[model samples]
Target chain A: MGSDWKVILCYSITVLYRLWWIPIRAWRLPLKNGERYFQDIEVPEGWHTSAEGRKWWRRYRATIIVPHALEACGLMAIALWGQWKQLPMLSLVAPVFVGMTLAFIAWWRHANRARIQRPQRVAVSLEERKLRTYFSWSLEAALAMLIAASWAIMAWRGDADIHWRWPLTLTYVVIGLIVMKAQVVKHGWALPANRTAEYQHWDEFRRRYASRVLDRMRFMNIVILAGYAAVHSLAGVAPIGAIRGAAFAAGLGLSVWMMIGIARGETAFLRGSARSLLPPATTIIDWKKGWWSFGAFMAGLALLMFWPER
Target chain B: MYLTVDFEDKRPLYQQVVDGIKELIARGTLREGATLPSVRQVAGDLGVNLNTIATAYRQLQEEGLVAVRHGFGAVVKARRSDFAGQDELRKGLRAALTQLVLAGLAEKEIVTMVREELAVVGGKAK
Candidate 1:
């Protein structure tokens, strides 16, 4: 309830919420591409409700459902725990709600992008289709479980009594398992389509654009890591409170900056005038598997959250 | 093995798959006794119905182009020594030529196109 506790709670919730959503965002990049590419197409009558269309509709629904459900369940669990314990953890939920709002705004902007209406049909490469399947079904689900388990286990193990912890833990774990099961789904073609020379060209451009954005993201991460290292290395001489506050501000600033940069970069690339594609289009690594990077981010945040109050 | 499907083409999906695989075989890209990608794999990769890919494989099996063994997926069957399908092949060629002629292709042009395609196949064989 106090300002200091509110700060700590907000910081913890921010890290956990981002960990849950970032992978979903990354994995849905292809689906986003499909939406953008088909934005201007005049599909045949009843295609959206046809068997082929329904298959793709299911994929999009599945893609959106898992992350939204996890966020909802986590919030409900936290709210229930707060009510039962008579705790003032509403501050913790504030930033997460803000994040969801921001995410929705960005998505709305993406959907409204100027439609280029190319004559080519919307098709995914064989490789992209497989990767989407693997991520949605296996990798992302596994990561979500780990995140939920870790959060629940730590919450139970930390200062809370066994009586209170069991219900909270059960709630969290049950939510996690349910979401994981639902996440084990494969995406289908957004449009009934195939790989062609033109599609290959588009894929190559996407890879080039994706790589450039990734390079920038990697640089930002390195800078943030070095900032933390510098702060920790100065712990001996600097006042601990001042050092911690500065480190928190710097880290949070870098994270917000990086996320905005990624969103803007994606938007610009999708709408960019540079239509030239590099030849010999190969299957570009989607980097949707950047869970390790996200893992490192969560680890850093966890370390900060549990840093001893001297 | 690589199997591609073009959804924009006028032909049925299974027929397109069959034609693509047949072309691969004719060019020796898929050699005799070589295994093909599983029906499931083809369907998954192409994002088509499983039954469509199965139908294509069944057609290939019927034509003696590939053998669909239970565990082995499909393998390009070795050319029969007796080779009694020439009449069938000739009939297919005539039908194809007739369609091309109906579509406004001249006889000389059709013959020239056929010769050019055979030459490419012959080159690949050598």
Candidate 2:
């Protein structure tokens, strides 16, 4: 494929993926609500009506999600512009990522404002806040490393085309899945402790998984770009052609294996009986809606597979 | 000025704050007649709303652990009669004993065990 065609294909995939995220984002708000209401049966003492308790929720939302959304948009713009034009994607993505990251720094200030503007009690606990912060930072660090590594791979292989490296992409996807599962498991375990604080529970689950999955998907796109570079570099060699063919076959095999594993794990998780293990203030997410959304995403992926790049 | 709140505890937040102040008074960290930080100042320092600290101070005032002046802010008044330096250790022991009892330890057995442990510690001190 010519360079322009490659750029166009990249841009198309980015747009397609962004479109897929729109429905998931819309679903997230209501799903969060459902989880909160469901988990509110047994909240711990001192959570509701406490000033610190109220502030925890404000910090969690403002510090975690708002900043994450801004960062994701900035990264998407970079990835989009880089592929659409010849300029370096990192230069565009990095500064914006830094700028958007300021939202988190402003979290405390925002929390104070929120507390003054609305004096309602927030139900999230200090322990929960610490856990969420740890997970959020870990995800952010992993994503940064993944992006840097992919870009480095591109720079290292200069003129050499690298085909879609399924292993690298799969690694990130697996990490995202693990993080999501861990979050859900945490919520499930916390259900019994403080049931009245279900809203905090649901918010934590959404905050952890949504940004995580989105970031990993963005990382996956960068891997796909690297693959595109590889394919373009090897347009003429007989031996390299044979190797590329084998890799493509292996990639397809691995993707299938991962899909089955993920589906099975999700099924088992959803089938298990619900336990009031989480704190009452925390929310327990409804797996039914989330699983349905996942299925929809998979179907979209299938369509992308058959879509003509030309 | 260092403060931490644990929301999961069954005790009310106001009670927790009062307990914390009582400990400070017992330890002489908050001396009699010493003015305490304004509720808003303490609340901001702890990342909590001002009302939480105010409620805590109110409880302390009711218990005579603190006296809230009109403009000067809350002040340490009289410490509890048992507000000696060893309240934390005593409180911890009481909690431990309660847990043991709840776990089915007989009262007599708990008393005997406490006596034995106290004897051991007393011997070491001597």
* Residue range A149-251, candidate 2, lDDT tens digits: 6456445553533333433444444454545444443432112223425534444555554444444444444444444445554445435566445544444
Interface RMS for model 2: 12.6
lDDT of 2 by residue, B23-125 (tens): 5566555667777766644553344566887888887887677888754468778766333358776898889988998999998999998888666434333
The residue pairs found clashing in candidate 1 are: none
Error of 1 at A196 (Å): 3.4
Off by over 4 Å in 2: A1-191, A194-223, A234-240, A250-254, A273-310, B1-126
The true-versus-predicted C-alpha distance at residue A27 of model 2, in Å, is 14
Task: Please provide TM-scores, in order, for all candidate models, with all chains considered together.
Answer: 0.44, 0.31
* lDDT value for model 1: 0.50
